[model samples]
Target: MAMPTIKAVRAYTVRGGGADYHDTQGYHWIDDHIATPMARYEEYRQSRRSFGINVLGTLVIEVEASDGTVGLGVTTAGEIGAFIVEKHLSRFLIGRQVTEIEKIWDQMYFATQFYGRKGVVVNTISGVDIALWDLLGKLRGEPVHALLGGPVRDELQFYATGARPDLAKEMGFIGGKLPLLHGPAEGDEGLKKNIEKLADMRSKVGDDFWLMYDCWMSLDLNYSIKLAQKAQEFGLKWIEECLSPDDYWGYADLKRNVPKGMLVTTGEHEATRWGFRMLLEMDCCDIIQPDVNWCGGITELIKISALADAHGKLMVPHGSGVYSYHFVITRHNSPFTEIIMSAPNADEVRPAFSPLLLDEPVPVNGRMKASALDKPGFGVRLNPEVKLHRPYAAA
Candidate 1:
């Protein structure tokens, strides 16, 4: 006889920070949703300047049946953690077995069908998928990355993200980029300052070190062209998000203008594999940064890398590199993944941050390495005692 499926799936959003966060009672008791009190650890995790900013406070889904067998999942939703579970996909996940992840994902897609696919719905699922993978890893005594296909690289090189020219060089990361920060002033003085940052960084860091600058979505064709011309003096390795997500023509034009060696990279907000394929077809980007959680999990990441390889582009997975580290380590010659070092208390979620999170925050001497872990799954272990704060409730 077939075993019974998960009969009831209830989710509790626990906060890890110290002290208690008052729940809006009016908001909490709607349907099967409930909130857990806050703890000190969680506040640090969710804090604007926490080291464990991105990876902590995952949504945990408990898959329990009347027979008592249980499965647990940890997922990423950035800051919108419980909202994803209690408000969005939690109800659809009832009655799923530990083995029914693919089916559950489909069910979630169907349930949230009215919201359309992408953005928050997809982000919520990304976290849920992470939780499922983690739960499975715990059940099997293996790390999530190991289950994905088995560990490959010995160490994952990390590039310090969110650095400007001086900070980038000072941190000893010769291989990273700074997000775009410019004002509306256009012309010679503005151009000079723009060019100077890159020039100064390259001068300080020396040659052979990779450097990138983020244009964000602010630059148009003229701005991109001007910046592209100025960037050559600094020998920038790549320019990220130089144009808007919708401006494929801008990329095409900027690509032609930015000389041959400087890479034009984008697509952190581009959704999934199909979105990436458009970039490939248009030859828009020399490097692709498909965020695995939002883009598509392990299954789709490999497919994306394969597509890039076939087309002579490299897949430099973006977003939370803590999780992306699994993908980076597995792919050969893939270098310089983004590391957004916030959440001051990083050790709360990723204990590896000590020796793992570099002083420079990139590979050693600007050549970081992905360390091998004896652990079974993603090599990340969570402190269950830590909880979530400010749980979202549907009123």
Candidate 2:
């Protein structure tokens, strides 16, 4: 069989202004949003786990071939470096072997040296590269896991990273956690309310549940320490991002204040192996959470997992879990995986690998288990029936 050659790649964006923020997770604390699916890009809210998960602009990359197969990749629009995929990336991919997804990733990463390395630009490269991997795998007849190594476990173990007041014990999650709050957590009375709320959730769910709290770059170290000390009573699995990502000293302090068992997890916002290396080298974090979207996709995710393995550490991928499911399924050593308990991102649910034809089969228990699309490439789906909410011209 001849390798499918890329013929064309097009980018599209969607924005919906002042739409109801129906992310549900955001409404856990504040009941302000309107809950309307956006038709086009909205500027304020992009896809993020913490802070505000408002829908802003969605970026879609469609790669077409002469054989009629097309692969689709998505990231939030309006990101600083996403343009590389939208503008310059297609030139290199127009007539190359889609199966050479790994080589394509390296080329894209190094090709953008002139544009200053790291952050959004490199991340966008990874997003497109992952979609292409899914495309390439489908072109053949193997799963993406077969390409990486092989499946470590049939079903991935996950924790409900987002918690709700009502479904404390009803939800059959291995672990559960309270939502993170921002810095301006009011005065002492407000802090008291936050603590009481967490305490109530714990009381409702009882022990034997691994609880997590996301700081989401909200609270300062001092406040985080106070909460961490108080939070020890509830038996949390980890207190995430108590300090800033850069504040190694704060992490060290928070780690010291909390019980030995309470983990200090961060790096969800951090990017790449080098960025994760900092978290590893300092011994600042007991657990590392790198978002697959922001991180350099599977190529770097495997490398980062290896780093964690060498350090005798644990790696749990962060947001927009397209790449995360693949990583968690293939790697045996990775400890715990996560699912956005609120609502999985729409883009996350979108099929990125259409040309190959696949599905990101979700777990029967509301988590993503393993890829059934054990074809030759990344087992992802690209739906031709997609109606672009905001096309480039339409925007």
Candidate 3:
């Protein structure tokens, strides 16, 4: 039995998932002068044929081992990730043993430090890091959770993130997290509408099932606190990413100001342990939600979770398909998991990354049995029918 050496690293830019595939109905990323909520902007943009939702466009990375095992990973980096993997990061991985993940991660991070400690660059590193984990899991003939010290719990309970908490309740999810449709620029009426929407959802879902808001990094300190204070009457469980991920002081202020018993959570957009340290040390948030794809992959997540646990905070990773599920089950601190309800109205349960992932796991009655993920590696493969565009190839 010999160790498998990485032979090549390839990046695939994949497209096509029909009209409903993109998660574009949330926040708008453009500058404030032109920025508007996605819903309002999308209609006009569509009419002009000048823009379309490209959020679903994915950059998938495949790391091939000398023994013919190919491990798969994906991210939101689009073509930029493809370029990083094919041209830069691949050099660090091409001949290394798959088991040297930490060393490889360090080299990749430091090598790219001058240009990338976060954002698309970290996203690029994430895709590669995940592929390496998938590779190692396959070589060892074990599921990723087993490699991460096995499950601490027998099953994973889930909450849904979508438009309809009522539908999520019917599907047996423990809670439903809705997107805040407006931001600070929307004014006082917008704040009223935000609370009104939560109140309406609270009336529908009733008092027992938890309801929370995914503010999506779109609120200011004053607006978030106002929204949180109003939302408390409706039993909001937490205000998530209400302020920018970088606003540690604002987060700390919000945490202190929010009505007691309502938690403040963030970090879905934050990257690396150093970034998360600011959140934890400042007592900025009660819970930390790191997206594995964007938060430096599972390697960094392990470190982040340990830090959260040390601080007595919950490490509920923002949903990223089975990648997060595998990590969630292995840790005690991650009490539950999140499922991105794919049904247009959040009425039906479907794999979050449907069409993109073959053999993807879905929760049964808001719970995922541990046995469901028993397959080797991440237990998933790229949907063969989907076209993968390899813009760059290693030499």
Assess each prediction's global lDDT (C-alpha) against the native: 0.56, 0.61, 0.84
List where candidate 1 sits over 4 angstroms from the true fold: 1-81, 164-174, 183-188, 343-371, 381-387, 390-395
The true-versus-predicted C-alpha distance at residue 317 of model 2, in Å, is 0.9
Better of 2 and 3 by lDDT: 3
Clashes of each: 41, 24, 0
lDDT of 1 by residue, 87-155 (tens): 766666555665577777777766775874676566566656655554556556665566666546666
Predicted model with the maximum TM-score: 3
Best by lDDT: 3
Query: Which is superior by lDDT, 1 or 2?
Result: 2
Relative to the unseen true structure, what is the C-alpha lDDT of residue 35 in candidate 1, on a scale of 0 to 100?
10
Q: Across residues 1-395, which tens digit of lDDT does each residue of candidate 2 receive? A: 78878877766543321111222343333222111122012332233323345344445566776686766565543333345665667667878887766777777777876873565676577667666766766666666777777777876766655546335335455776566542333546656766787787788877776777876666677777777777788786788866667777777676677776788888876777887887788787888888666677777787888998888888877745445666677776675577554333221222222222235554444345565535455545544454444333211
Better of 1 and 2 by TM-score: 2
Deviation (Å) of 161 in candidate 2: 2.6
Off by over 4 Å in 2: 15-56, 78-82, 113-118, 165-168, 182-185, 343-359, 366-386, 389-395
RMSD, one per candidate, in order: 9.6, 6.1, 3.7
lDDT comparing candidate 3 with the true structure? 0.84
